[model samples]
Target: MAEYITEQKRTLKKILEDNCDRAYTVDELFCKMQALYPSKAPGKSTVYRLITHLVNEGAVKRFIKDGERKAAYQIVMGEHCDCHLHLKCTDCGKLIHLNDKISDELLSTVQSTSDFSVNEEATVLFGTCGSCKKHSER
Candidate 1:
């Protein structure tokens, strides 16, 4: 079997560094690994193992979308913080990560009223993007 990853850890590091925001499915990531080493593609088992290992190391992140069987993966950058919310466009589905801090009152009100902890990392609000809104009105 061809070994695509000579230094497996380094490969993961490079991929994360290359595109932190670009989310990729495991299969997609496997395809990318093949591209990185056209002559030595990792097998399915190897790919799964690598992904699992990376996730456990906190080097990768995973999320589910559209009720898919597989989760999307991205590289973890800096300290994992719940200090942002994602703005997702309802029309185009374009997503932007918002890093603006929330006022203590609002945060407190949400916590106290809802009796729930707010996770900034997974907080995604859906709305029309500026371009989409303008286009729609016209």
Candidate 2:
């Protein structure tokens, strides 16, 4: 069995994974966490503590998105945690993570030629969102 994370850690991770689109402040994270774990709403310090733990364990990733905050966290899954490239959309500010959809020969060439490994992680692919594109055309 996967070792059970503490209640705070598990709940926090769950909330983060569910809301992968945006980063959250401590208070915001606390509120979201409470939705799943209403009986245990931790203070800011406790929340921070759990986040730090998740970070160190590589279960979470921190990056700066176009927001008022300095950094945001996203839960890492499978090979997405070891991403090689990221895509960011300029018009709508929507970020979607991507892994390469490439041919085996090309993939082999890259591995042989470059000093990098295939990061089969989700990368943020940014582009005008559908709503933005629709509005812009009008």
Candidate 3:
């Protein structure tokens, strides 16, 4: 039998899906959840637990940005959980998924040359995005 999903979990999943381009810390997600459904908002602990469960179930991805105190979570849809590396914008905190054949070639090269394997599922590269770079240039 399939496991049951509570209303809180469903709401959290929806929020994550709606904001697929970015990640959110537990506190941030909690605040947004509360804002979206004031009367039905779950507690912070509940949101955290649900997110943890989703991560375990391979339904979400968790990452920690440089100098960040808390980890952020993003929803994993379709092949995104396996077929891509994540690029995080340091300025705007946007997370972009890069699914290019070049990434696979780089992974292969690393493994062949250095005897080290890249964990693509959890790998994140931090840099300024194109929009951020343009904004800074102006």
Candidate 4:
């Protein structure tokens, strides 16, 4: 038989999937969950537990952004968790998945030059996105 997914888990999954472009704090996710399912909203602890479970299962990715007290969580789709650097926008809090030939070249360079193997899963670069930069300049 197929494993049964709980309602709370389904709701949380939907929220993360829907906001894949941005990361959400535990509190923020809780609030959104409550809004979506006020009658059966999971508690804060439950949200945290579920998120942790997802992370361990490789279905979600969690990271701390600069100047943030709480860690943020985002859904991991397909090969995103395996081979891409995440770019986080400081101004808009948008998370962009970067997978380019240059990134591969950089990885090759690092491997060729040193014994250190880059951890792509945990790699993140923070900067203002183009839209945010333009908005700030205007």
Candidate 5:
């Protein structure tokens, strides 16, 4: 049983890491896991448990999607993720890690001009990604 649970956790981690650019709701994750391994897919509760574990470990970021109450999860890109703001594609749900230099400049500018401090870890700019913008232009 422990081995099966560990396997399921590994599978879930792979799914999240492989698609680092996208965020997934719990239901979506559950469905994807089911689709990938019909026989070995973890149950909904198990998926939730694994997600909780990942979030606690700082390997995942959890946030509520815009205009929705349910939360979404995405894989943390690297050790630097906490130091930079993120960009999310509204059209495709892709998450882009902002370059460090640019992020620092932006944050510095905001701090120098306004009294409000931005939380890099929780902040995400939403817009159409380059690929989605190109597709729409066609």
Candidate 6:
């Protein structure tokens, strides 16, 4: 049973890492895991448990998406996630990690003008993504 749990944890981590382009709710992740391992996917409770662990370890970020009551989780892309703001696509649920250079400049400007420090980890700019905008135009 211990070995099985370990394997489940590994599989869940891989799924999040590979799909780092977007955040997923618990139900979404469970369905994805079920699709990948129909016979052996862990239960939804187990998925939540493992996700909590990942969040505690800083390997994943969990946030309440805009205009939603449920929380969503996404894998942290790089080592410096705390140093930059994130952009979340409202249409497709994609999460974009802003480049460090751009993030730094923005942060600097905001600080200089407003004298307020933004919590990068908790800050997410929500908008329609490029793909969604293009598709909508068609």
- Between prediction 4 and prediction 5, the one with superior lDDT is 5
**Candidate 6 per-residue lDDT over residues 51-114, each given as its tens digit:** 9988898788887755477889988764466778888777756678887789989988999999
Top candidate, metric TM-score: 5
Q: If ranked by lDDT, best first, what sequence of candidates would result?
A: 5, 6, 3, 4, 1, 2
12-118 per-residue lDDT for model 3 (tens digits)? 99898877777899999999999999998888998898999899998887877444768989886634447767787877566786756867988889999999999
Q: Estimate each model's TM-score.
A: 0.51, 0.53, 0.57, 0.57, 0.60, 0.59
What would the per-residue lDDT of candidate 4 be over residues 1-138, giving only the tens digit for each residue? 113336687778888877776788999999998898898888999889888988898788787744566788888664344566678777756678776666677778898999678897778789998877887788
Error of 1 at 30 (Å): 1.0
Model 4 misplaced regions, further than 4 Å? 1-5, 78-138
Query: Which parts of model 3 have CA positions greater than 4 angstroms off?
Result: 1-5, 78-95, 98-138
| Each model's lDDT | 0.65, 0.62, 0.80, 0.78, 0.83, 0.83
Give candidate 3's error at residue 45 in angstroms: 0.5
Q: Pairs clashing in candidate 1?
A: none
Q: What residue pairs are clashing in model 6?
A: none
Which digits, one per residue and each the tens of the lDDT, describe model 1 over residues 1-138?
235453765675577557655667778877887889776667767777877777888777666533356677766552333455556666644455454565335566798999977776656788877767887788
Question: Model 1: how far is 29 from its true place, Å?
Answer: 0.9
Q: List the residue pairs that clash in candidate 4.
A: none
TM-score of 4: 0.57
Question: What is the number of residue pairs that collide in model 1?
Answer: 0
Residue by residue across 1-138, what tens digits does model 2's lDDT show? 234338668778877766655556676787776676677777778888888888899877665544345556666543343433444556534455444444334456768999565543443445765555776788
Candidate 3 local lDDT, residue 55: 93
Q: After superposition, how far is residue 19 of candidate 4 from its true place, in Å?
A: 0.9
Q: Write the number of the candidate with greater TM-score, choosing between 3 and 6.
A: 6
